[model samples]
Target: MSTPHPHHFRPATTHADWTKTDQYHNKYLLSQDEALEFALKNTDANGIPLISVSAAQGKYLYLLAKTLGAKQILEVGTLGAYSTIWMAKALPEGGEIISLEVNPKHAKISTENIAHAGLSSKARVILGPALDSFPTLSPSPPFDLVFIDADKDNNGPYFAAARKLVRTGGVIVVDNVVRNGRVADDSLQTTDVVGVRKLLQMVKDDKGVEATTMSTVGDKGYDGFMYILVNEGI
Candidate 1:
Protein backbone atom coordinates (compact mmCIF):
# COMPACT_ATOMS: atom_id res chain seq x y z
CA MET A 1 0.00 0.00 0.00
CA SER A 2 1.44 3.36 -1.02
CA THR A 3 0.10 5.89 1.48
CA PRO A 4 1.20 9.31 0.34
CA HIS A 5 -0.37 11.11 3.31
CA PRO A 6 0.82 10.71 6.90
CA HIS A 7 -1.31 10.03 10.01
CA HIS A 8 -1.72 13.66 11.02
CA PHE A 9 -3.41 14.36 7.68
CA ARG A 10 -5.54 11.25 7.53
CA PRO A 11 -9.35 11.40 7.07
CA ALA A 12 -11.15 11.63 10.38
CA THR A 13 -11.16 8.14 11.91
CA THR A 14 -14.90 8.66 11.97
CA HIS A 15 -16.34 8.35 8.46
CA ALA A 16 -19.28 10.72 8.64
CA ASP A 17 -20.30 9.98 5.10
CA TRP A 18 -22.98 7.32 5.08
CA THR A 19 -21.81 6.52 1.57
CA LYS A 20 -18.40 5.57 2.94
CA THR A 21 -19.59 3.56 5.86
CA ASP A 22 -20.69 -0.08 5.74
CA GLN A 23 -24.12 1.54 5.27
CA TYR A 24 -25.51 3.51 2.36
CA HIS A 25 -26.45 7.15 2.37
CA ASN A 26 -29.24 6.23 -0.04
CA LYS A 27 -31.75 3.43 0.00
CA TYR A 28 -32.54 1.14 -3.00
CA LEU A 29 -28.83 0.41 -3.06
CA LEU A 30 -27.17 -2.69 -1.72
CA SER A 31 -25.62 -2.16 1.69
CA GLN A 32 -21.85 -2.35 1.35
CA ASP A 33 -21.56 -4.67 4.36
CA GLU A 34 -20.91 -7.83 2.35
CA ALA A 35 -18.60 -6.17 -0.15
CA LEU A 36 -16.60 -4.31 2.50
CA GLU A 37 -16.27 -7.40 4.65
CA PHE A 38 -14.90 -9.27 1.69
CA ALA A 39 -12.37 -6.54 1.03
CA LEU A 40 -11.11 -6.38 4.63
CA LYS A 41 -10.83 -10.13 4.92
CA ASN A 42 -8.84 -10.42 1.72
CA THR A 43 -6.80 -7.22 2.00
CA ASP A 44 -5.10 -8.10 5.30
CA ALA A 45 -4.16 -11.58 4.15
CA ASN A 46 -3.05 -10.62 0.63
CA GLY A 47 -0.55 -7.88 1.35
CA ILE A 48 -0.64 -4.80 -1.01
CA PRO A 49 -4.39 -4.78 -0.69
CA LEU A 50 -3.29 -1.96 1.55
CA ILE A 51 -3.38 0.39 -1.46
CA SER A 52 -7.01 -0.10 -2.50
CA VAL A 53 -9.46 2.72 -3.08
CA SER A 54 -11.48 3.30 0.08
CA ALA A 55 -14.97 1.81 0.32
CA ALA A 56 -16.24 5.40 0.31
CA GLN A 57 -14.55 6.00 -3.00
CA GLY A 58 -16.05 2.85 -4.43
CA LYS A 59 -19.51 3.73 -3.18
CA TYR A 60 -19.21 7.21 -4.56
CA LEU A 61 -18.38 5.84 -7.99
CA TYR A 62 -21.24 3.36 -7.76
CA LEU A 63 -23.67 6.11 -6.87
CA LEU A 64 -22.51 8.18 -9.81
CA ALA A 65 -23.05 5.25 -12.13
CA LYS A 66 -26.56 4.75 -10.89
CA THR A 67 -27.31 8.43 -11.26
CA LEU A 68 -26.04 8.41 -14.80
CA GLY A 69 -28.10 5.36 -15.74
CA ALA A 70 -24.88 3.69 -16.72
CA LYS A 71 -25.36 0.48 -18.66
CA GLN A 72 -21.71 -0.17 -19.43
CA ILE A 73 -18.72 0.65 -17.26
CA LEU A 74 -14.99 0.16 -17.58
CA GLU A 75 -12.76 -0.02 -14.53
CA VAL A 76 -8.99 0.17 -14.81
CA GLY A 77 -8.20 -1.69 -11.59
CA THR A 78 -9.91 -4.57 -9.82
CA LEU A 79 -7.98 -4.85 -6.56
CA GLY A 80 -9.39 -7.75 -4.52
CA ALA A 81 -12.59 -7.24 -6.56
CA TYR A 82 -13.87 -4.82 -3.93
CA SER A 83 -14.51 -1.97 -6.37
CA THR A 84 -15.80 -4.33 -9.02
CA ILE A 85 -18.58 -5.42 -6.67
CA TRP A 86 -19.35 -1.83 -5.74
CA MET A 87 -19.80 -0.76 -9.35
CA ALA A 88 -21.62 -3.90 -10.44
CA LYS A 89 -24.08 -3.87 -7.59
CA ALA A 90 -25.32 -0.41 -8.54
CA LEU A 91 -25.96 -1.09 -12.19
CA PRO A 92 -29.47 -1.22 -13.68
CA GLU A 93 -30.75 -4.47 -15.06
CA GLY A 94 -28.30 -5.58 -17.77
CA GLY A 95 -25.74 -3.06 -16.53
CA GLU A 96 -22.18 -4.39 -16.47
CA ILE A 97 -18.74 -3.57 -15.15
CA ILE A 98 -15.77 -4.71 -17.23
CA SER A 99 -12.86 -4.51 -14.82
CA LEU A 100 -9.19 -4.80 -15.73
CA GLU A 101 -6.54 -6.32 -13.48
CA VAL A 102 -2.84 -6.69 -14.27
CA ASN A 103 -2.24 -9.85 -12.32
CA PRO A 104 -3.98 -13.10 -13.20
CA LYS A 105 -3.99 -14.14 -9.57
CA HIS A 106 -5.75 -10.96 -8.51
CA ALA A 107 -8.24 -11.37 -11.30
CA LYS A 108 -8.95 -14.91 -10.14
CA ILE A 109 -9.67 -13.71 -6.64
CA SER A 110 -11.86 -10.94 -8.00
CA THR A 111 -13.79 -13.49 -10.03
CA GLU A 112 -14.56 -15.41 -6.88
CA ASN A 113 -15.63 -12.28 -5.06
CA ILE A 114 -17.91 -11.20 -7.86
CA ALA A 115 -19.49 -14.63 -7.91
CA HIS A 116 -19.85 -14.60 -4.17
CA ALA A 117 -21.77 -11.36 -4.47
CA GLY A 118 -23.99 -12.97 -7.09
CA LEU A 119 -22.79 -10.41 -9.61
CA SER A 120 -20.79 -12.69 -11.88
CA SER A 121 -23.05 -11.89 -14.80
CA LYS A 122 -22.93 -8.17 -14.09
CA ALA A 123 -19.13 -8.01 -13.98
CA ARG A 124 -16.40 -9.27 -16.26
CA VAL A 125 -12.82 -9.49 -15.02
CA ILE A 126 -10.21 -8.74 -17.62
CA LEU A 127 -6.79 -10.28 -16.93
CA GLY A 128 -4.17 -7.87 -18.31
CA PRO A 129 -2.93 -4.32 -18.55
CA ALA A 130 -5.77 -1.91 -19.36
CA LEU A 131 -3.77 -0.41 -22.19
CA ASP A 132 -3.49 -3.77 -23.90
CA SER A 133 -7.06 -4.94 -23.42
CA PHE A 134 -8.69 -1.54 -23.70
CA PRO A 135 -7.72 -0.93 -27.30
CA THR A 136 -8.74 -4.38 -28.39
CA LEU A 137 -12.40 -3.74 -27.83
CA SER A 138 -13.09 -2.55 -31.36
CA PRO A 139 -16.32 -0.64 -31.81
CA SER A 140 -16.61 -0.88 -28.07
CA PRO A 141 -19.89 -0.29 -26.31
CA PRO A 142 -20.49 3.30 -25.32
CA PHE A 143 -19.40 3.08 -21.73
CA ASP A 144 -21.53 5.37 -19.58
CA LEU A 145 -19.02 5.35 -16.77
CA VAL A 146 -15.27 4.71 -16.60
CA PHE A 147 -13.24 4.35 -13.39
CA ILE A 148 -9.45 4.43 -13.40
CA ASP A 149 -7.72 3.14 -10.25
CA ALA A 150 -4.62 1.39 -11.45
CA ASP A 151 -0.97 2.41 -12.03
CA LYS A 152 -0.54 6.15 -11.64
CA ASP A 153 1.99 6.58 -14.41
CA ASN A 154 -0.57 6.01 -17.15
CA ASN A 155 -3.21 8.51 -16.15
CA GLY A 156 -3.02 10.51 -19.35
CA PRO A 157 -3.09 7.54 -21.67
CA TYR A 158 -5.85 5.93 -19.67
CA PHE A 159 -7.88 9.12 -19.79
CA ALA A 160 -7.48 9.20 -23.52
CA ALA A 161 -8.71 5.63 -23.71
CA ALA A 162 -11.53 6.36 -21.30
CA ARG A 163 -12.67 9.25 -23.41
CA LYS A 164 -12.99 7.00 -26.42
CA LEU A 165 -14.96 4.31 -24.60
CA VAL A 166 -17.53 6.50 -22.89
CA ARG A 167 -20.55 8.11 -24.55
CA THR A 168 -21.19 11.81 -24.84
CA GLY A 169 -22.96 12.02 -21.51
CA GLY A 170 -20.67 9.53 -19.84
CA VAL A 171 -18.39 10.25 -16.88
CA ILE A 172 -14.73 9.41 -16.20
CA VAL A 173 -13.42 9.11 -12.65
CA VAL A 174 -9.73 8.68 -11.78
CA ASP A 175 -8.96 7.71 -8.20
CA ASN A 176 -6.12 9.25 -6.18
CA VAL A 177 -6.34 12.63 -7.86
CA VAL A 178 -5.17 14.36 -4.68
CA ARG A 179 -2.13 12.09 -4.41
CA ASN A 180 -1.70 13.06 -0.77
CA GLY A 181 -2.23 16.72 -1.64
CA ARG A 182 1.10 16.70 -3.49
CA VAL A 183 -0.34 17.67 -6.89
CA ALA A 184 -0.99 21.29 -5.87
CA ASP A 185 2.65 21.67 -4.80
CA ASP A 186 4.85 21.78 -7.88
CA SER A 187 8.03 20.87 -5.99
CA LEU A 188 7.02 17.22 -5.64
CA GLN A 189 9.03 14.86 -7.84
CA THR A 190 7.21 11.54 -7.46
CA THR A 191 6.05 10.08 -10.77
CA ASP A 192 2.52 9.40 -9.53
CA VAL A 193 1.96 12.93 -8.31
CA VAL A 194 3.34 14.43 -11.48
CA GLY A 195 1.21 12.16 -13.61
CA VAL A 196 -1.95 13.19 -11.75
CA ARG A 197 -1.00 16.86 -12.10
CA LYS A 198 -0.79 16.45 -15.84
CA LEU A 199 -4.19 14.81 -15.98
CA LEU A 200 -5.76 17.65 -13.96
CA GLN A 201 -4.25 20.14 -16.36
CA MET A 202 -5.73 18.24 -19.26
CA VAL A 203 -9.17 18.29 -17.70
CA LYS A 204 -8.97 22.01 -17.02
CA ASP A 205 -7.77 22.91 -20.51
CA ASP A 206 -10.11 20.81 -22.58
CA LYS A 207 -12.97 22.84 -24.06
CA GLY A 208 -14.94 19.90 -25.32
CA VAL A 209 -15.22 18.41 -21.85
CA GLU A 210 -16.89 20.07 -18.86
CA ALA A 211 -15.69 19.02 -15.39
CA THR A 212 -15.88 19.93 -11.73
CA THR A 213 -13.45 18.62 -9.07
CA MET A 214 -14.52 18.06 -5.48
CA SER A 215 -11.89 18.39 -2.78
CA THR A 216 -12.41 16.43 0.42
CA VAL A 217 -10.54 15.20 3.52
CA GLY A 218 -11.05 11.61 4.60
CA ASP A 219 -9.74 9.00 7.06
CA LYS A 220 -6.99 8.11 4.63
CA GLY A 221 -5.38 11.56 4.79
CA TYR A 222 -5.46 15.06 3.35
CA ASP A 223 -5.61 13.40 -0.06
CA GLY A 224 -8.84 13.34 -2.07
CA PHE A 225 -9.75 12.11 -5.55
CA MET A 226 -11.38 13.97 -8.46
CA TYR A 227 -14.08 13.01 -10.87
CA ILE A 228 -14.03 14.38 -14.44
CA LEU A 229 -17.63 14.69 -15.52
CA VAL A 230 -17.65 14.56 -19.30
CA ASN A 231 -20.59 16.26 -20.96
CA GLU A 232 -20.07 15.42 -24.56
CA GLY A 233 -23.15 17.38 -25.54
CA ILE A 234 -25.11 15.41 -22.97
Candidate 2:
Protein backbone atom coordinates (compact mmCIF):
# COMPACT_ATOMS: atom_id res chain seq x y z
CA MET A 1 0.00 0.00 0.00
CA SER A 2 1.18 3.54 -0.80
CA THR A 3 1.19 6.25 1.82
CA PRO A 4 -1.52 8.86 1.30
CA HIS A 5 -0.67 12.49 0.66
CA PRO A 6 -1.14 14.74 3.70
CA HIS A 7 -3.77 16.86 1.99
CA HIS A 8 -6.00 13.93 1.02
CA PHE A 9 -7.34 13.61 4.54
CA ARG A 10 -10.02 16.32 4.74
CA PRO A 11 -13.60 16.60 6.05
CA ALA A 12 -16.95 16.13 4.36
CA THR A 13 -19.28 19.08 3.74
CA THR A 14 -22.08 18.98 6.26
CA HIS A 15 -25.53 20.23 5.15
CA ALA A 16 -25.97 21.69 8.62
CA ASP A 17 -23.17 24.22 8.12
CA TRP A 18 -24.53 25.21 4.74
CA THR A 19 -27.94 26.04 6.17
CA LYS A 20 -26.53 28.24 8.91
CA THR A 21 -25.23 31.00 6.67
CA ASP A 22 -28.35 32.69 5.34
CA GLN A 23 -26.67 34.53 2.48
CA TYR A 24 -24.29 31.73 1.51
CA HIS A 25 -26.64 28.82 0.88
CA ASN A 26 -29.85 30.72 0.14
CA LYS A 27 -28.70 33.19 -2.51
CA TYR A 28 -26.06 30.97 -4.01
CA LEU A 29 -26.20 27.15 -3.82
CA LEU A 30 -29.97 26.61 -3.78
CA SER A 31 -31.28 29.81 -5.36
CA GLN A 32 -34.81 28.95 -6.28
CA ASP A 33 -36.78 27.77 -3.28
CA GLU A 34 -40.06 29.03 -4.68
CA ALA A 35 -39.38 27.68 -8.15
CA LEU A 36 -37.99 24.47 -6.67
CA GLU A 37 -41.13 24.02 -4.61
CA PHE A 38 -43.31 24.48 -7.66
CA ALA A 39 -41.10 22.22 -9.73
CA LEU A 40 -40.77 19.60 -7.00
CA LYS A 41 -44.32 19.97 -5.70
CA ASN A 42 -44.65 16.63 -3.85
CA THR A 43 -40.99 15.90 -3.19
CA ASP A 44 -41.02 14.61 0.40
CA ALA A 45 -41.26 17.92 2.22
CA ASN A 46 -43.30 20.83 3.51
CA GLY A 47 -43.14 22.70 0.16
CA ILE A 48 -42.07 25.91 1.87
CA PRO A 49 -38.38 25.22 1.12
CA LEU A 50 -36.77 22.19 -0.47
CA ILE A 51 -33.55 20.26 0.07
CA SER A 52 -32.18 20.76 -3.41
CA VAL A 53 -28.46 20.55 -4.15
CA SER A 54 -26.18 23.52 -4.53
CA ALA A 55 -26.54 25.39 -7.82
CA ALA A 56 -22.77 25.36 -8.17
CA GLN A 57 -22.62 21.57 -7.94
CA GLY A 58 -25.69 20.99 -10.09
CA LYS A 59 -24.39 23.12 -12.97
CA TYR A 60 -20.96 21.52 -12.73
CA LEU A 61 -22.34 18.00 -12.93
CA TYR A 62 -24.55 18.97 -15.86
CA LEU A 63 -21.54 20.26 -17.74
CA LEU A 64 -19.60 17.09 -16.96
CA ALA A 65 -22.43 14.97 -18.36
CA LYS A 66 -22.15 16.81 -21.66
CA THR A 67 -18.38 16.87 -21.63
CA LEU A 68 -18.04 13.16 -20.91
CA GLY A 69 -20.67 12.29 -23.49
CA ALA A 70 -22.37 10.39 -20.71
CA LYS A 71 -25.20 8.15 -21.97
CA GLN A 72 -25.92 6.14 -18.83
CA ILE A 73 -25.57 7.76 -15.44
CA LEU A 74 -26.55 6.95 -11.89
CA GLU A 75 -27.17 9.28 -8.98
CA VAL A 76 -27.43 8.07 -5.37
CA GLY A 77 -29.68 10.87 -4.23
CA THR A 78 -32.83 12.41 -5.74
CA LEU A 79 -34.07 14.96 -3.28
CA GLY A 80 -37.34 16.29 -4.66
CA ALA A 81 -35.88 15.51 -8.10
CA TYR A 82 -34.43 18.99 -8.42
CA SER A 83 -30.91 17.77 -9.21
CA THR A 84 -32.26 15.03 -11.48
CA ILE A 85 -33.59 17.66 -13.89
CA TRP A 86 -30.15 19.19 -14.33
CA MET A 87 -28.57 15.80 -15.02
CA ALA A 88 -31.34 14.36 -17.22
CA LYS A 89 -31.49 17.46 -19.41
CA ALA A 90 -27.77 17.18 -20.07
CA LEU A 91 -28.04 13.63 -21.42
CA PRO A 92 -27.20 13.30 -25.11
CA GLU A 93 -29.74 12.09 -27.65
CA GLY A 94 -30.74 8.54 -26.64
CA GLY A 95 -28.84 9.05 -23.42
CA GLU A 96 -30.44 8.11 -20.09
CA ILE A 97 -30.21 8.68 -16.35
CA ILE A 98 -31.46 6.55 -13.46
CA SER A 99 -31.87 8.28 -10.13
CA LEU A 100 -32.70 6.51 -6.84
CA GLU A 101 -34.53 7.92 -3.87
CA VAL A 102 -35.88 6.19 -0.76
CA ASN A 103 -38.78 8.53 -0.26
CA PRO A 104 -41.86 7.42 -2.17
CA LYS A 105 -43.42 10.88 -2.15
CA HIS A 106 -40.24 12.44 -3.48
CA ALA A 107 -39.95 9.75 -6.10
CA LYS A 108 -43.44 10.46 -7.45
CA ILE A 109 -42.80 14.17 -7.52
CA SER A 110 -39.49 13.63 -9.24
CA THR A 111 -41.12 11.47 -11.89
CA GLU A 112 -43.59 14.28 -12.48
CA ASN A 113 -40.83 16.87 -12.65
CA ILE A 114 -38.95 14.85 -15.27
CA ALA A 115 -42.11 14.60 -17.31
CA HIS A 116 -42.67 18.33 -16.94
CA ALA A 117 -39.12 18.91 -18.16
CA GLY A 118 -40.03 16.74 -21.13
CA LEU A 119 -37.27 14.30 -20.18
CA SER A 120 -39.19 11.24 -19.03
CA SER A 121 -37.90 9.45 -22.10
CA LYS A 122 -34.34 9.82 -20.82
CA ALA A 123 -34.70 9.43 -17.06
CA ARG A 124 -35.87 6.75 -14.63
CA VAL A 125 -36.75 7.48 -11.03
CA ILE A 126 -36.56 4.53 -8.61
CA LEU A 127 -38.22 4.74 -5.23
CA GLY A 128 -36.53 2.24 -2.88
CA PRO A 129 -33.39 1.67 -0.89
CA ALA A 130 -30.50 2.37 -3.24
CA LEU A 131 -28.18 0.24 -1.09
CA ASP A 132 -30.08 -2.99 -1.59
CA SER A 133 -30.75 -2.21 -5.23
CA PHE A 134 -27.11 -1.26 -5.95
CA PRO A 135 -25.72 -4.78 -5.67
CA THR A 136 -28.34 -6.19 -8.00
CA LEU A 137 -27.85 -3.37 -10.55
CA SER A 138 -26.96 -4.95 -13.86
CA PRO A 139 -26.04 -4.31 -17.45
CA SER A 140 -22.75 -4.32 -15.54
CA PRO A 141 -22.22 -0.62 -14.59
CA PRO A 142 -19.30 0.74 -16.63
CA PHE A 143 -21.60 3.69 -16.19
CA ASP A 144 -20.01 6.73 -17.85
CA LEU A 145 -20.30 8.66 -14.62
CA VAL A 146 -21.74 8.24 -11.13
CA PHE A 147 -22.65 10.89 -8.59
CA ILE A 148 -22.81 10.14 -4.84
CA ASP A 149 -25.11 12.54 -2.98
CA ALA A 150 -27.39 10.35 -0.90
CA ASP A 151 -27.03 9.39 2.76
CA LYS A 152 -23.77 10.41 4.45
CA ASP A 153 -23.21 7.20 6.40
CA ASN A 154 -23.35 5.02 3.31
CA ASN A 155 -20.69 7.01 1.45
CA GLY A 156 -17.96 4.35 1.76
CA PRO A 157 -20.34 1.69 0.51
CA TYR A 158 -21.32 4.05 -2.29
CA PHE A 159 -17.64 4.49 -3.16
CA ALA A 160 -17.20 0.73 -3.35
CA ALA A 161 -20.35 0.54 -5.40
CA ALA A 162 -19.00 3.25 -7.70
CA ARG A 163 -15.90 1.18 -8.34
CA LYS A 164 -18.11 -1.71 -9.35
CA LEU A 165 -20.49 0.19 -11.62
CA VAL A 166 -18.44 2.89 -13.35
CA ARG A 167 -16.46 1.94 -16.46
CA THR A 168 -12.71 1.63 -16.24
CA GLY A 169 -12.26 5.13 -17.63
CA GLY A 170 -15.36 6.59 -16.01
CA VAL A 171 -15.59 9.24 -13.30
CA ILE A 172 -17.16 9.32 -9.85
CA VAL A 173 -18.01 12.70 -8.34
CA VAL A 174 -18.75 12.80 -4.63
CA ASP A 175 -20.40 15.97 -3.32
CA ASN A 176 -20.17 18.17 -0.22
CA VAL A 177 -16.67 16.98 0.66
CA VAL A 178 -15.39 20.22 2.21
CA ARG A 179 -18.02 20.84 4.88
CA ASN A 180 -17.30 24.19 6.59
CA GLY A 181 -13.59 23.35 6.39
CA ARG A 182 -14.21 21.68 9.74
CA VAL A 183 -13.28 18.55 7.86
CA ALA A 184 -9.74 19.86 7.80
CA ASP A 185 -9.77 19.81 11.58
CA ASP A 186 -9.54 16.39 13.24
CA SER A 187 -11.72 17.14 16.26
CA LEU A 188 -15.06 16.83 14.53
CA GLN A 189 -16.91 13.49 14.38
CA THR A 190 -19.82 14.28 12.12
CA THR A 191 -20.91 11.16 10.21
CA ASP A 192 -20.62 12.55 6.67
CA VAL A 193 -17.40 14.40 7.22
CA VAL A 194 -15.66 11.42 8.71
CA GLY A 195 -17.17 9.16 6.11
CA VAL A 196 -16.04 11.41 3.26
CA ARG A 197 -12.49 11.49 4.57
CA LYS A 198 -12.44 7.71 4.70
CA LEU A 199 -13.90 7.48 1.23
CA LEU A 200 -11.19 9.80 -0.11
CA GLN A 201 -8.60 7.48 1.36
CA MET A 202 -10.05 4.46 -0.41
CA VAL A 203 -9.90 6.23 -3.76
CA LYS A 204 -6.42 7.55 -3.08
CA ASP A 205 -5.09 4.08 -2.27
CA ASP A 206 -6.56 2.41 -5.30
CA LYS A 207 -3.69 2.41 -7.79
CA GLY A 208 -6.19 2.04 -10.61
CA VAL A 209 -7.63 5.54 -10.13
CA GLU A 210 -6.58 9.20 -10.12
CA ALA A 211 -8.29 11.68 -7.80
CA THR A 212 -8.50 15.22 -6.37
CA THR A 213 -10.86 17.27 -4.17
CA MET A 214 -11.96 20.79 -5.13
CA SER A 215 -13.35 23.31 -2.70
CA THR A 216 -16.25 25.68 -3.51
CA VAL A 217 -16.37 27.61 -6.79
CA GLY A 218 -18.54 30.80 -6.95
CA ASP A 219 -18.05 32.09 -3.44
CA LYS A 220 -15.17 31.84 -1.02
CA GLY A 221 -17.95 30.37 1.01
CA TYR A 222 -17.59 26.59 1.30
CA ASP A 223 -19.75 25.54 -1.62
CA GLY A 224 -18.46 21.96 -1.44
CA PHE A 225 -15.58 19.82 -2.62
CA MET A 226 -15.64 16.99 -5.14
CA TYR A 227 -13.35 14.00 -5.25
CA ILE A 228 -13.01 13.25 -8.95
CA LEU A 229 -11.90 9.64 -9.22
CA VAL A 230 -11.09 8.40 -12.70
CA ASN A 231 -10.19 4.84 -13.52
CA GLU A 232 -7.80 3.92 -16.40
CA GLY A 233 -5.83 7.16 -15.97
CA ILE A 234 -3.40 5.71 -13.45
Best by TM-score: 1
Tens-digit lDDT track for model 2 on 50-147?
A: 64665555667888888888888988888766777788878888888888888876677777777777788988887789887787676343688888
Candidate number with greatest lDDT:
1
Q: Which 10-residue window in model 2 sums to the lowest lDDT?
A: 29-38
lDDT of 1 by residue, 1-234 (tens): 977657558554444552354343333443538766776577567664556666566678778888988889889988788878888888978778899899987887778778878898899898988899988764245888888888887898888877877788788888777865688788887889888877878888777687766665554444666677677722
Alpha carbon RMSD to native, model 2 = 8.5
Candidate 2 residue pairs in clash (backbone atoms < 3 Å):
11-183, 13-179, 29-55, 142-167
* lDDT (C-alpha) at residue 97 in model 2: 87
Give the CA lDDT, 0 to 100, for residue 92 in model 2: 81
Cα error, residue 144 of model 1, in Å, equals 0.4
In model 2, what lDDT does residue 43 have? 54
